[model samples]
Target: MSEWTVHGSRTIYTSPWVELDLVDVEPPGHPRYEHHLVKWAPVAATVLLNDRDEVLLMWRHRFATQTWNWEIPSGIVEAGEDLTVAAAREVLEETGYQIDPRRLVPLAYNQPIGGMSNAEHHVFLGRDAVHVTEPVDAHEADRIEWIPLDRIHEMIDRREIVAGVAVTGLLQLLARRCAY
Candidate 1:
């Protein structure tokens, strides 16, 4: 199949986290028209492990989804910020678990929404973490805890870890047993 041809794009709105664009495009064997395109900031997240082989997780309430779930530390990568550094920053800010940026190794990369959005995710694996301070972003999660890696599948099966990025990171860790 041929690639979609983009003639032009007009920004409808934009913010630090998201942008709305109307792109003039022609898909193969289709009519050319303006399509709504969503542009999102790339996200970075980490599935961190402790010496006991437990995974660090947070019990969070997502207001938009109106659901409570367990998730790994994650946040939008800032402009010009290092992806690994950003993942480490999120770990500390959201969970109070300080991790060496260098220790974070890439585990998975995915563009969650490709047809209508430029949303992307980078998931990392961290073999070590240290708690140096209380969480700086107190509003991020209500509870932070270490979960046994063996229980991840149960939690996921029960929909406890429903966030796509979080699920992706955890599943990759389980599938590959990635040691870094």
Candidate 2:
């Protein structure tokens, strides 16, 4: 397989969170094709731990998938916002934890769906997260809890921690633990 060249692109739809584009592309040895591309704003997700060493997580039921799972606090990084700031803001808004932006350490990055979407996820680790208030976002989560580290694998095996970014963040933390 060879790289596809985009001759041109036009926005098909635009929203606050996403933009869809129709791109004219030419693949090697093939005629021109119009491909539908979805552009998602960059995302920032955080693995937050309290002083007690328990990881903070949101438990929610996703209507899209009809499943309840544990997830990290995450949100889109607004244009021109620093990734660390976005991570801290998300955690604060979604989980009511005010994490110091300076303490938010980059952990990993990934493209959940690389084929037709341009959504890059930035994951961070926030240690000693402090609770400042109740969740400010009305629709943030069904519940928030601090789960012990040893129970993380149990939750994963039970399919209770299902969000891709959340899973990736925890895996990175677990890997780093092994390294030390």
Candidate 3:
């Protein structure tokens, strides 16, 4: 059992994308405290690798953070949608690449911000992706490229790849490749 207990929770706001709540929690040695909590649909991220040993990346500006960085294609898994299907659909919509759902290998999952949010990100490694069309979402990326896998660590060291999901996904793929 956890050392803390949630006594009650009240919804502060609700939207199609996210929900916020105020939770009353009691810890072992402290009085009850109210914590702000956020709930969101789980996300699926794909590390798409082409035959040239390059990984697909999107370069875009995140308004919230006011920083431009490289990120993997990812999106929320809609209700009633299969995880793999959702990941492939996100890749197609964001990068104009059609990837076989079967080629999506589960890599790892993470909760990037457990203190304030209850959202899980499922990461996958996809291979054999083919360009089908331009990105359907105009804001998906300012530019897309297939960057050499060998330079991922260098990019990370240069702080060009900053998104948590993308960094974790790529590192997992790199680790797995080295293990083989």
Candidate 4:
């Protein structure tokens, strides 16, 4: 398939977390038209696994979805922030787990809503994590727990772990584990 030509884009809304834009575009074999584009700042997330075959996760309710689910430590990366550093920082801010940024390895990257949005997710795997303090973003989650990694598949099947980035990271880790 050929790429659609973007003639111009105009911002309809702007916020620190997200933006709405209207773009004039022309498809390869179609007429030109204005399309809605949803945009978000780059997001970074980390799946923190320990030697005990457990993964750090947060139980939280997403207001937009109005559903409770388990999620890995994740947040929007600040403007000009390094993705790896943002991943580590999110872990500490959300779960109070301090992870060495240098120890974080890229695990997965996805534009989950590519059809109408430019939301980028960068997932990292951090195996070396230490609890340093209570969660700084306490309101972000109802509970923070170390969940058995083996139960992840079941949790996901039960709709407990449903965040796209979290699912992507955890599944990628599981896939990697089985590969080795």
Model 2 spans with C-alpha error above 4 angstroms: 178-180
Measured against the true structure, the TM-scores of the candidates, in listed sequence, are 0.96, 0.94, 0.96, 0.96
CA lDDT for candidate 1: 0.92
What is residue 24's positional error in candidate 2, in angstroms? 1.2
Cα lDDT, all candidates: 0.92, 0.90, 0.92, 0.92
lDDT of 2 by residue, 1-180 (tens): 979888999998999999999999999998998999999999999998766668999999899999999999999999999999999999999988898999878888999999899989999988877778988995879989999988998899999999999999898888797542
Per-residue lDDT for 28-130 in model 1, tens only?
A: 9999999999998899999998778799999999999999999999999999999999999999999888899997889999988898998999999987688
Q: TM-score for model 3?
A: 0.96
- Give the number of colliding residue pairs in candidate 1: 0
Backbone clash tally (model 2): 0
Candidate 4 C-alpha lDDT tens digits along 1-180? 999999999999998778899999999999999999999999999989898989999999999999999999999999988899999999999888899988888899999999999999999989879899999899999999999989999999999999999999999999998542
